[model samples]
Target: MSKSFNAYILESRDKPLIIMAELIRKALIVRFQDKRDKMKNYVGRICPNIQKKIEGLKELSNQCIPKWAFDNLFEVKCHGEKNIVNLVAYTCTCRKWDLTGIPCKHAISAIFFKHEVVKDYVSHWYTEDTYMRAYKYIIYPIYAG
Candidate 1:
């Protein structure tokens, strides 16, 4: 006697954490490419000291995104609504916006409502100590014999 066989399949959904990581990855890649293009056309090539600052800007830019993302950002929607906009810097409720600091459509709209808050939301690496230290040192030139 012969028996017939049948197979069944199940679909899977990605977890929030996995989705957030992917978004971050995409944002980072685009940011890198844009920075590279800017560096190439940089006019500081003529000055050694200025060049160093430009080079430093390149290196610093890599680490200059933000810390709030790592820690996680939170938000609220309506006056009585629960925190719907739970877009922590790294994990946006919408997924794409949070992962990448590009700001989601919703965030962009919200920003218009609260521009000051949004401006503060943007992470600035130039304010960091490391970059400040790099700018503090004098760039004295030495003559070659």
Candidate 2:
């Protein structure tokens, strides 16, 4: 995000354009390496951030009540609202699951009713494999002239 770059801008100020550019590049490489290292220690199928979100959703799902409608279909009642969840289709009437690629509380309740793991229902884009692939390539370090 811009917040990362914004913090380095002040440090690069008063330097020549080329030097500033190199400084920013070095900063980014270090930042990326740190991220990669942090991810290496994380052991989960889904990325840590998304996993945290799922954990929060799991807690919320406990409040929902799921009723069997038909095969792969469930009617979930949560907070006085009714949401239809289709396990096979991976969809919820509330549309939160469709929008976020992560199952919403309603869908999670239905998922729990089926005795299935919520992580398996998450989109591949949030998988650890995808995340590692994104940061796999190392940035070559440039030496000072």
TM-scores, all candidates, are 0.28, 0.86
Candidates' C-alpha lDDT: 0.39, 0.91
10 residues in a row with least lDDT, candidate 1: 4-13
lDDT measured at residue 84 in model 2 versus the true structure, 0 to 100: 96
* Model 1: per-residue Cα lDDT over 1-145, one tens digit each: 0121111111112437766555554554554565455545554322334334444433433332222222233353432332324334423455544554444434433443333344344334322332344344443433447
lDDT of 2 by residue, 1-145 (tens): 5786687576986799998888878887887798789889998889989999999999999999999999989999999999999988889999999988999999999999999999989999999888888888888887667
- Give residue 127's lDDT in candidate 2 (0 to 100): 95
Model 1 misplacement above 4 A: 1-84, 87-91, 94-102, 114-116, 126-138
Shift of residue 41 alpha carbon in model 2, Å? 1.4
Native-to-model Cα distance after best TM-score fit, residue 110 in candidate 1, in Å: 2.4
User: After superposing candidate 2, which stretches have Cα over 4 Å from the reference?
Assistant: 2-16
Best by TM-score: 2
